[model samples]
Target chain A: MSSYIALFGNPNTGKTSLFNNLTGSYEYVGNWSGVTVEKKVGILRQHGVPIVDLPGIYSLQPLSRDEGVATDFLLTEPCSAIVNIVDASQLRRNLHLTVQLLEFGKPLIVALNMVDVAEKRGVKVDAEKLSRCIGAPVVPVIARTGKGTKELVRAILSLSEQSGEREHVAIDYGQDVEAAVQKISEQLPDDLLASKRWLALQFLEGNERIHAYLQTYMDIAPLVAVRDEAQQALGRPLAEHIYDARDKWIVHAIETSTVIFQQKPLTLTEKIDAVVTNKYLGLPIFLTFMYIMFMLTFDWLGSPLADLLDQFFSGPLTEWLSKLLTLVGASPFIQALVLDGIVSGVGGVLVFVPQIFILFFFISLLEDSGYMARVAMVMDRFMEAIGLNGKAFIPMIIGFGCNVPGVMAARTIEQPKERLLTILLLPFMSCSARLPVYALFAGTFFAKNQAIVVFSLYVLGIVVALGLAKLFSSTLLKNESSIFVIELPPYRMPQALTLWRSTWDKGKGFVRKAGTFIFGGSVAIWLLTYVGPKGIGVSMDDSFLAVIGGVLAPILAPLGFGTWQAGASLITGFLAKEVVVSTMNIIYHAKDMDLLQGAITQHFTPLSALSFMVFVLLYIPCLATVATIRKEAGSRKWTLISIGCALTIAYTISFLIYEGGKLFGY
Target chain B: MVLTDLRQGQKAVITNLAITNEVVKQRLLHMGMHEGEKVCVKCVMPFGGPVMVEVDGQYICLRRKEAACIGVR
Candidate 1:
């Protein structure tokens, strides 16, 4: 049998990096918490076993979906050995989970990570002493740069070879709690798989999920009786006492196994946070960073490269593809599909790849530099007004990159109402997929201030989303928990390699999307314009794309850009936002962006172009997002309401922008 | 006094976490803020924002209300 090893740790402890080193696979690693919200499995080359990387969770008892994912996997998943990663700098707190894992009765090897960081703070840990104390093999390793990883791998393989269970070590939970734990363990059914003491302790600590799971196997009445009896005798919640025991043990363990010296004061992260997270200056600093990012992407590097790629695809590439088709004696229909449909459609979306990567680069920087958690702290006040804490804002930041993961990131919110609200508001964050449409329109019409123009749309998306969050909180989902406690990881300069890898991870999806479904979508769309209800080779005006677009056009006229071509593009945009540019390219029969720009000018003024971008910014999310909403929301009614709300808000906002612009005589 | 009652940069040993919410209390404990631990105020954001607190070299940001539930001396 192939053995499986699970890598577990607290959030932001570099477990993903360690997994990458062991498995030789690239998974997105973020310095902030909750980056890995689900379990990821990769094969470990050294041991020839599958390594499961679970989410970074503070405890086995869950308060949120992501935590539940990790907790569930730890309790239920079958693994021959467990490699528990502990951040040495934060060992006291991280050891709480380490104790629970030890109680899990598995062959465990503890990987003590960040020892160098600990040493920097005048703390020195004796790995041999820690190993002796915990009764597990401990190896110090730096997960980021592969320092001391060989020892960790050796320990893991040696333990895997033994195939023996570690002795289940029970923490002294005082007298009453110990009595209850013993009773609960004896009463537990034989069918139970995990350690009975671990489950009973978890139950006493108010792990409702485990409690519910245990009820299915046994009556649980005897256990509940023992718990209530223990609670009455103790005069404090068993959980608090359990934590008290853990804290006492940690203090003792630290004294015996570690040494502390006077620490260096005021690191670079502190000096920077003094200004960037200052009361008055934090929001301004955040806005400035965003402004700079946009300026780089739109007005500087990204736009120029995108323009070059656009011209190449529109002129030389299209001409070369056409000639190749002619040389092969292909049919006129096939030639049109390859050139007009696939090339123009996919090529139109492909040109924006540079901008997508630039945006990803900035996002990765913010995430890797540990700025995102501070943004949560900085944005807490406004978030409170919307009935959420600063922790909820992390999902919004992630949403600016892509809504699917952003929506999934909501799993970390801890509050069900807030998680749903975050999901509902995510579509308005203006994902990178929509960047192409905004860049095309802004570059074409708002040339001198394209950066400012695109930046305003991003701000608009936030304003509208926040406003709706406020509305939903007051009317639909009332009584938020308003609990916000977040860990602030120390800032480090983002490594160049990590930044490149992260950017490529996010940006590759766009290109792969273009190569796969978007290629087919483009061909299908071109055929819609090529073959209509009037049959093959009908005029675009009479094509099926036009017929459906015509139905939606009048409704959009009030928001400007009411033409059939614009309507058809919006219709295809439902498939994916990049397809909007593709549909427009094919409809205008434009060979290059220069031609596409000239063709759009005939149908839209600068004001109308701005209005059209606004609609795309707030309108319904792509099909993948809608499916995620359906699944994550877990209710058909909520999903429909989400779509309905997005459409209503999009129309209202676009109408206001268009008519309001005309009223001001712009 | 409560955790938020401390001046910025003032350090104190935690006496108790007088919090009722089960999840919040468990979370604070798991984050290494149990009784007898030491914590120092780092900064408090302006206008009802979260207060940044440092405990054993790890920084944690907590809402003012939640921070108030933590007793220190």
Candidate 2:
């Protein structure tokens, strides 16, 4: 029988960091709210008990999909204890959830995280006093540096050791509301998961989940009547009355245990925000940061390392591996499988790992430094004008790294219509996987302006995504977009370990995909290219891959890369975007990357190559992304809409580019 | 007046939330925007963007339209 303890907190309270410290597992920790969309489970190292990290939530009554997940988990999962983490600096606001958590009556330990940050602002929290007042052990811990983590773990172990019947603190809603709650509670089944009083409060507040639960066990009309009676007596929505009660309770708790010195002057975060989020300077500063990030990724760091790796893979690695295979008496077919299929296919994708890592590194830095939230704040108006909210920008930026998580990140957007629209347009943000295609083409065709060419493609993706978002909002998913109420957390230096872990987590996914999807895809493509309808070892032109590519070539003819090789690479790209580069690597038989670049220049004029890159940028997202769209959107209709819209947009844009170039006679 | 009427650096107490949408109301309440809580207008983004408000020691950025629904004095 394994006991479970859940780490719960408000957003950006360092719940994930504390979970990481206790469980020794690195889950993605961001400085903004809603970073952890799903709950993650890991075993505590000291107690060997499984600890779950729930998504950050404000209250038991969920306002968003991610918050609903946290609430749902607490309702369904049986846990021995809950380690409720709260930001000490925002103790009053954070305690709103803590007060609600106390209603569940589980063995609870309150980890007051970020105490040092609070102290810096001239706020002092008496932990022992807070512990006594809240009736839970309050441990001051800095989750980022792992300070007080051992004490936290010890508290949890001791909490589980005690009999789970702890004193539950209940807020006293006024007499009328209390009477209504008591009336509703008397009707609830004894075997219910949470306290009857909690359920009654939820019922009176018109919680949909609680209402539906009442419908199953008993006739909900009586409960509804009592709730209405209570509302009529209280002269307000039950939720409002309940909120007032909890607010008073939280204010009392804060006044008892916390002291504030004289108001501090504008802190570092405010000073930074004064400029970074200035109305006139905000967008420019954001754009400048983006430019710097891309410059660093492409020109300064990533591209050079990628080129070095490309040379190593094409020259020394291939030579040594081929020689070793020949010495082992491996047949020529086996040699091709090892050196060409596995090595070239996976290696071609791996060559871009440096660029991907650097891109993720900057993204993590932005997210962990708390700048990502401000980006959302600055971009909100622009996004709202285009029929979305500012928060949608966060996912779009994430889409630059990959569309799968970008689409999933839309869960943070409370509006269903806006979220769906965000998911549909996410593929237009040319992800890092598509970088290899751009790098290969831009480096070859537009060598003098490779950086500019790549930058233009990214800009093009955003423009198209926005255009389509506007179109969708006006037509298909039209609705009043939800209000934007995002928190701007104080800026802090990103912890090195957390930053490295996030970068590695994203980079590791790329490597794993390269190993499995790209490796298998490369072999399948190799077989198709090698074996003709007649037999094996046929000329490349007569191979089955050529036959298929020839069939698909006409569809792509207007985009200017209608050749069989382009068609085949685009087809393989469905597995993953990077496979397009690997497929081209295998088909052109350019073992030397320099020769490959030369071969590409000979085949594609700069204009046609640009058209092709644009096509790849807007075309159907990889299969994983499409599947994620289906899951996230929860409708085949919307998934097909996404795929259809992407394909149509890609073709239309590429066609215009290709024909428009021909008119210019470049 | 609604929260949007507040000038930069103006301080007021939230008098009421005029939002009709339940989700929006819940979200605001969860962020500690209950009536009687003190709110300070931190900054207003140009071009009618969000109004940044400091409440309960947290800086929250709300769109102008959303802010328009927040009654304050």
Q: Give the range of the ten consecutive residues with the poorest summed lDDT in model 1 chain A.
A: A164-173
- Which residues of candidate 1, in runs, are more than 4 Å off? A1-3
lDDT per residue for candidate 1 within A444-486, as digits (tens), equals 8999999998999999999989999899999888976666778
**Residue A264, model 2: Cα distance from true site in angstroms:** 2.1
Interface RMSD of 1: 1.4
> Can you write out model 2's per-residue Cα lDDT over A1-666, one digit (the tens) per residue?
455798889988999989999999988889899898888899999678999998888887777778778888867788888899999888888998898788777888999998888888878899999998888999999998999999888888888889557876778888998898788888888887787887888777667866766687887888888988888888877777787788788888889999998567448888898899987999999999999888878788878999999999988999999999989999999998877677868887899899899999999999999999999999988888889989999999888888988887888888888888889889999898999999889888887788888999999999999999998889877757556779888898887877898999989999999988888998999899999999999989999999999998998888888889999999889888999998888887777568778777776888889999998898898999999999989999999988898899899999999999999897
Q: How much does each candidate deviate from the true structure in C-alpha RMSD? A: 1.7, 1.6
Report, to 2 decimal places, the DockQ of model 1.
0.76
Worst 10 residues of 2 chain A by lDDT: A476-485
Q: Which stretches of candidate 2 lie over 4 Å from their true place?
A: A1-3
